[model samples]
Target: MTGVPTGWRNVLPHLDYDLPDDLPPQSSLSGGVKVNLPLELLRQSRSRAGTVEIPGEVLDQYRRYRPTSLWHARDFGEAVGARVPIYVKYEGANISGSHKLNTALAQAYYYRRAGVQEVVTGTGAGQWGTAIAAACAVFGLRCTVFMVGDSLRRKPYRGTIMRLLGATVHSSPSGLTEVAAGAREGASGNSLALAIGEAVEYAATRDRTAFVIGSGETYSILHQTVIGTEAIEQLAARHAEVDAVIGCVGAGSNFGGIAMPFFADAAEGAGPAPLLLAAESSTTPKLTRGVYAYDRTDATGFGPREAMYTVGSEFAIPPAHAAGLRFHGTAKLLSAMRHRDQIAATAVGQVEAMDAARLFAVHENVVPAPESGHALAAAARVATSGVSDREAHHVARRGILVCLSGHGYLDLAAYEEHLTERLRDESPDDDLIKLATTALSAVPIEGGHLRVP
Candidate 1:
């Protein structure tokens, strides 16, 4: 097996601008205070180093599937009519079949060392839940997951996988916690925020269990930097230089994982200085349409008040095959960078994303997860549409590097919908979006809101 990256690259130290501090976790009325983070994770969150050494155990586990293949993707580029060299880093090659496991294993290692016997978290599409469950099993810890209701229905297999991994899974708003039970039924009946709130509440009340996030948070993003670290080395080995780093933005973990190394170079005026681009779903276009604001990280308003580009925690999430991208808020770190022009983001419709995946599958014989398809669509958009409106990102497209966050094998249901042309292409309601965002006025945005160029 190829040697795995021993150190995880840190993105915080590479950024020039400051991401405003989030409000501390509020004391849960029914279940004690919410935050129970591990010490190492908190340290990593505050780290400003170029790289943090991976724990020996975590490094050992990563050997199972580190150095995921970086493909030339010539067939896909030709099919899309791309002129530049196109490459892709496939994160789905791991046993967990997604990038979430990168952080899951690390968190489990830290929590186990910290004497935490159980770990719990919410999942939008089930990948995070499965990763955590598998990690907990490896570390001999108990696991629990709160899955979004819509996703639970659309992808029951995700829940089944978690259960098989020894996780106790509950559908969000399942009456297990007040936060879940009282959550407003939006378009999808449950949002990612609500599921996360339930997990927080569940962890808060339980003894020796901590709520660990898969994405959107700094620590999680740090752990995921292995993706970019490996990609950089592999591309250099192939004598390829990248000018653009693209990935889908589902809380920005996968995007940050693959782009942050290039982002560091851009900040330091070194290397290729690639254009860091994030592709997001139109239905939850926080980076594209929502204002920079301070808002609760969950539906219950009991979690931390995070500074991010948000459509509001209460925004009704549209029911889409890419459940992972249905969250209302972008990651705080990504939002801050976008505001400062260090990163660029664009949103595309479900149909466009799905069609891009179709093109990729036909040419490359590897179906991209519907969430990752957004990045695929953006790559095609850049290749075909030219850099007319994206001057902020870059005009140069020397070589395109796309992060195919996961495999679409388990997401065949979405493909079936796309093939039959029965997939509902739903966009977020403007009126509802306005109504939902109105609550942001209640939160102070002085330090949080940055002017977008």
Candidate 2:
């Protein structure tokens, strides 16, 4: 794989901004108190070096499933009656059944080298937890995952898998930690923000334990570059070019991994930049309707503030079938790009996404995770709309590459709800959104565009 494009850091100066010298002094209540954001991690995340070398140990693990297949979805295209071809990189082929493993192993390796004895983390749909658990098993470290309670209940087998991998799992807000204790005073259901708070608290209180984030970090996103790097090479071998690259955006890991390399190509004037499209849940349409502002990454107000499109860290999101996409904020890099109109985004309702997933399953013979279904739904929209007319003159053939981030075998319960027409699209109340906006305004930050009223 050709490493990240040389000088890619120069493409987005805003994203590569200098780290805040006045970071809050380390404290248990503050974000990154016990586990500070390592300078090396930040540097690597924003480095322009063309090809950060993968460690031999990490490469050894990657050999088990490094080069995931990029398949031409001719059958799906035919089913959708698309005039152009469609391609998909199936990330579910791995043992963990998702792309989460790509970054998990890298993070586990780093923590192991740092002499961390245990890693605490949060998971939305259990994929990240399962991946980390497997990585920890490989590295001989202990793992504790605070899983979203609703998801844990819905996908019980995922927790079982984590246990089998020797990771301890708990339901978020389970009265096990101080953060969860506080969270339970007001709310009870699982949310990404709540789980993060618990995980951070767990890490902060322990020695030789570090908090590992699943997404919304530079390091994690960089590790995910493997996806895009591999896809670019696979596409080159077939002498094909994509007109658009689409992926579902929960925390933007998979999407960023697959799209950043192409973004680098665009930066270098190598070729026209493929249209970058992010599909988000209408239930928590952070990209579509949230404000672009400096906000905390977790519900408990821990961690360095980042500039991103957000629905407020404290905003109570309604439960949706696609639990993974229920995050309150987009990744900072993706947020910056969207703010500058460098990429496009759309929100899809749960029913619409489920319908698209069913159609795809009929043709492709794979049930997509609810989160991945968003991208499939978006791709179907593009194919049927004949949106290629705008760029038809510039390119002879129109093509789309959608990242099927994971399989839905473990999410059959969600499908059952959808099939029974019992699934409901639950959006946060307007009043709650207003409350969140007001709370966010209290934070003193400069250079943020607060679009929310």
Candidate 3:
């Protein structure tokens, strides 16, 4: 354990589960056969225990960049004419420039301890892949990243960085895997689900190789709690009360990381909880328009079926500049929280998100990743609305905390497209959404009681 503050340990056990129960069984399809997931990982995912001890070596490595800085965005707040103070937790200060590294290092350390020689995983915007690749290099392990085809083609720099870290990067839905090869036919864009399928397929056929996922799992969320733990302490030192905490959601790792600690306070009746908000891409509005149901975690149905808000594993989402928010489903725990009315979600189009990013850059002097811009967009929306009604006591002053999950130095092209108005603001039509729902209806769901079509 990396010396967590007092009372922080009390929040850990309740972070994932409110009650003790058996972990749900999940089925994975490989070689046209359905197989159960490994029980070891499943047990850890279901465990209610809050804290996972960080190994000494992992902690030593994290010392280089772990406690990210939280900045009070006074200038940005002034430009937005916000009546409240805005704080940005900048996770882009690290080498990989994203919060993904928080879990990547932890995962790599576990793989090295288990004697695994290689780790295979999927990446959408390439941040997770880059983070994991860097982590593997530090731990003297090999990494194979199956990057989403669209992202691989559009963000060549991300792939270059991963390669520079000594990781093998392949464009997913390519000819590398039989399943991806078949699925690539006539497909216009690549999704996180498709990349996951490719990674799982490759890992299943090899020995001493393990498939790791960047998000949508409890362990990933557990590894991410450091973000919230740090944020709480930082805010306490400033004597600030957070009215709301917002973050962009793909598989909900970052949002869950920051929000869960506050939720623990609410759960224990220790303090008033901050409003939890998730910002998502309008192109793939899983939280805003998706149905709560049991859906496969991967495109080819080669992973566990999670109870989440999904647009179907087979849904073909329109390409957006915020590639990191292109996943089909959210984390199961986040989905459950939304279902229980514990969180609120909203969708922002690429154009609006870009506009928010530009406004942030001009005032804050930091270029935010397009995915993180979604949270900025949401913050802007709240600021524009005065942010007073959301509070219970109707205080004279208000505070908003936005999780700037990553920097966008590698995403200059995306900003250029937005500035040039080449990026489309339109979302997929009703017909496309219906097509995705229809595909989801065909998949058989077993464990979850809720179904949406």
Candidate 4:
């Protein structure tokens, strides 16, 4: 094995599991159906004692899904005044058109092997739901998705796709309490709903279902390492080097996937460690602008409370155009990366992100999601700054990689709204930030359940 990077050794310490021998071969059942064993055993294994196995078929499917091509945006590089090369790993090309599928597939396979009857999750841009739905269909498992009300209304295609995949989808804030009722009444103004919070609550309350967030669970990040694993191969094939890696920070799954592998390489001194940059919505700047605090995923009704960054500890949030970014805080892995200064966080407003999307379509021929556009905007800002080319170059240096988390096909209406100037630009107000920080500043009482507003 290649030498592990120094930073990774320090960060991850001793490896939790060893790498396995050749992947297990796929098995065929009675009806000529192909079955994966290694992936199942590895995912379902509770021993955590050694390297696990994944069926060769699953690994083959993984290869087909990964090592997604990297693109050199010459025009974008020129537009951004960057003389160096800039490369982006366009993950939107995935089967579900988002990075969520990478984790969803693994989670589904693992859960199915573990005898999980169902999987529950929350989605923002609907990418996560679509991914989970597809995985569930592949594994013949049931999936229930809770979507923010605003997203369900604004992006019906997402819901339709989920249904088509045979998953049940629900809009939060529709019932269950007065808070939900009031929130539903106010939902038409913005598509964001109380679904994610409700989904988490539901999952936590259930015994047969496992709740998966777009971002959460460190194991999820481990699954995403496949992206980095593939990226290393792809970049090397191109005889190129990455100076940095950038991706939007909604739930941070995509960001973590690509960054962690490189981090592993850096830990072992395999090569130069690329800087990790995470872009978030200015309107929902959980890491860059928000403080470290305990905040519920949704505040419309009493819901499962998870520690996250918050804009308002008590105030329920209105929906924003970047539906995927309406969350209140950062994931533990992301928080750890930030606290260690291994990753830098930046905030981009809706307008700027939309503009970046437009530029991407025009110059790159791919329409990026608003969340991805946020990263594009950050890349643009960093590239265009008057900093020395080398300095700036290193920031988003040519060969820099960006995770195209998802496509905007389902979000065409959002594109239209943006084109028509119907989408408003917003950033967190100082008072709101201060209020949220104040509310989260006090440490939560351990083992005391949160009392959702």
Candidate 5:
């Protein structure tokens, strides 16, 4: 097997276009200028380095579960009548039960170095909270998480896991912060965005506490490039030729982790580039049907404005079994890629995605996370599409790489709901989506950008 990568790939400078930097901070509810964050992280967000070396401490922690297994799903491919080989990169070996630990450890290390005592953040489905909680325990820092109220109710065990890891968890829309108070009266009563706003306000109002983001930030996505870089070496050792790389999109970091290297190679003309696909839930229409615009990054306008494909930061988030996929906007980098036609996105129905997870479990003896199930379902579609790319001028199918971002063992509650036929699909409102887009358009554009925002 190939070893872990010493450095994480950074595709920020190679995106073929420049992205806007954050504007001056608007005053938050705490009567502060902005959220207090680690200066190193803020610098990294603007860095154009092709590759940043992973600190020794972070590397040591990564080695414990770095080289995640990548197996050829021949049995599942045959069962699904695929014409190409299906390879799955399973990342469930990590203790966090998801790929989020990759960034959580890096952030915690940076925070601890910056002389920060405590970290505050938000979570969805509790994976990011659990990850940050464990990282804080390792780094000798305190963690506080504001999880979506709906997600906390459905996955109480996840919150329990975070608490067991020594984190203090709170349900969003609670009386913790004034931002959450606004959320309680707004359309986005309980959402990842609202929780982020609350976390930012709390951090800004408190001393020695910094607000850390779990996903959708530029630095967070850059830190996750290890997943894609390692997969590159593993595929080379196996001599596997890939035609497509697929992953489920929440705020986009999970998919970015596995596809950044491939996309970077394509931009550099290093070799043949595979088709990139983003799989998301139909309920979260950000990457699929949402309009690209400059929207507030967090709820209540406490964060910077970013150009992304968003269904408006104020839209009522639909409750889906895959809570991680309930976010209303895609990451800035991922939205940029989509705007440039560098990737394709497809929405999967709730029931259909769970069935795909069950099929994979029955055939491969592994239960994928509900979010990853969307990618698995997309892989099945690509394999059975019977369509060929004219650019390649050949009907030859090579392989499809699926990033199984996490495991479903801790998410049995969702599976139970699905098995009992209680899970159903929820569709987005066209008029409401249009309303959100229109409001974002009037937010006043800040800097130079492309067809993106």
Candidate 6:
């Protein structure tokens, strides 16, 4: 490992590491993954059928907004405690107000390089779609976004933004495709139904478009390391070292991405790895409470070998407030790490998560998305406990990292509902569990000592 970055060391205390002169390139040995096509193929004429680049202007625009802000939550500490130091990588400050762009930008870069003329994707709450649509606008590629109809009706600002950015935005169940047709036939009222899996499947089946997913276990996990890389630098600048790192996990992108590098460092004997903890909603506490199993993503008989802790099959999930965390399974890569006992997991109830968000807003002056409150609450719990004694100090000295994934502006309606007592507390019902177990039984390949079909 190279020495710590000088810029970071100046701000953080007791930091260590040699800072490399250049950022490391993506490793070919992709941790139990095989690249179906060399990354270079993304940019070659042979692969793209002759598209050359993402355009210099777009690259320049991205450079303006590329690297985002990181901060030590000093105020958060005052309320929680002084012992546990909390640092947050505030992706909420980004244009789309979330870390979705971290992966979206990379995917766009690859797709444009691959000569893909169009990008197709789906969004439940619209953050991912907004990020990708913005990236496509900059890259001069056409973007097609399928938004869950309910979210579209609720968050019109997102749709307006997509159009202004020059992308085609459609509310799913609009009868544009078979997925929409099926949804219409099924006919649920005012549903938040972008049909993410269906949208991705449609894009993948096309030769002209590259399918993009907002979040997945591994894909986003790979991109989120940038957060860890930056945080490590920022903490080093502060001359500080953290004992634990905590983040909320929906599809496992933000948490896995940021923690993996530290885990790698520990694996290399560089130092101790922070106790990595992933927080999920009790309604969909797949990681901490789920039985490990081989599973499918969309439950629709599509998706990869999504090996992870998930509530249901990908195609189907019980409705939950944290819209993004509704996926059926986790990323296979993150799941493996969990099995190896390299990370810890926890699940918080919806009201608790919401209360955490309110507390954070009152203290930190930022209204966090409900998804992010899970980690915030977890970190707060750890910080509140005394750390003066060795046993308690261990708890206090922990480093808490929150991936402020996105702002909750689009979700204000939900918040309003919460305040008005209009929203009912809901969770994974027994029927949902039965559905999930049934989906798990469909997978043929079995490993990791899990019960098989």
Name the top TM-score candidate: 1
TM-score of 5: 0.93
Whole-model Cα lDDT of every candidate shown, in order: 0.82, 0.78, 0.77, 0.64, 0.82, 0.62
Q: How far is candidate 1 from the true structure (C-alpha RMSD, Å)?
A: 2.2
lDDT of each residue in 1-453, candidate 4, tens digit only: 122111111124423332211222122112221222234333432233222344444455566665566778878767667646677777787657888877687778777876677787777778889889988888888999877777788888888889999998887654543334545355432433356555645665555676555565455665666666666767787788877787888767778877877776776778777777788887777676665455554543333344554565344455666777766666655664564456777778888888888888888888888888888877776665521221233344545777777788777887898889898876657677777567453224333332221
**What is the lDDT for 419 in model 1?**
87
- Estimate candidate 6's RMSD in Å: 8.7
**In candidate 3, residue 177 scores what lDDT?**
77
Per-model TM against the reference: 0.94, 0.90, 0.89, 0.80, 0.93, 0.79
Over 8-29, each residue of candidate 1 has an lDDT whose tens digit, in order, gives: 8887887665677787654445
Off by over 4 Å in 2: 1-39, 184-187, 386-397, 429-431, 441-448
Q: Lowest lDDT 10-mer window, candidate 4?
A: 1-10
Superior candidate under lDDT, 3 versus 5: 5
lDDT of 3: 0.77
Ranking by lDDT: 1, 5, 2, 3, 4, 6
* Model 2 residue-pair collision total: 1
Q: Candidate 5: list runs displaced more than 4 Å.
A: 24-27, 33-35, 184-190, 386-396, 442-453
Q: Mark the regions of model 3 whose C-alpha exceeds 4 Å error after superposition.
A: 1-41, 184-188, 386-397, 438-453
TM-score of 4: 0.80
Stretches off by above 4 angstroms in model 1 are 24-27, 186-188, 387-396, 441-453
For every candidate in turn, the CA RMSD to the true structure comes to 2.2, 3.8, 4.0, 9.0, 3.0, 8.7
Task: Please write out the lDDT profile of model 2 over residues 384-441, one tens digit for every residue.
Answer: 6733321231221578888999999999998999889998877666667667766454
* Candidate 1 Cα lDDT to native: 0.82
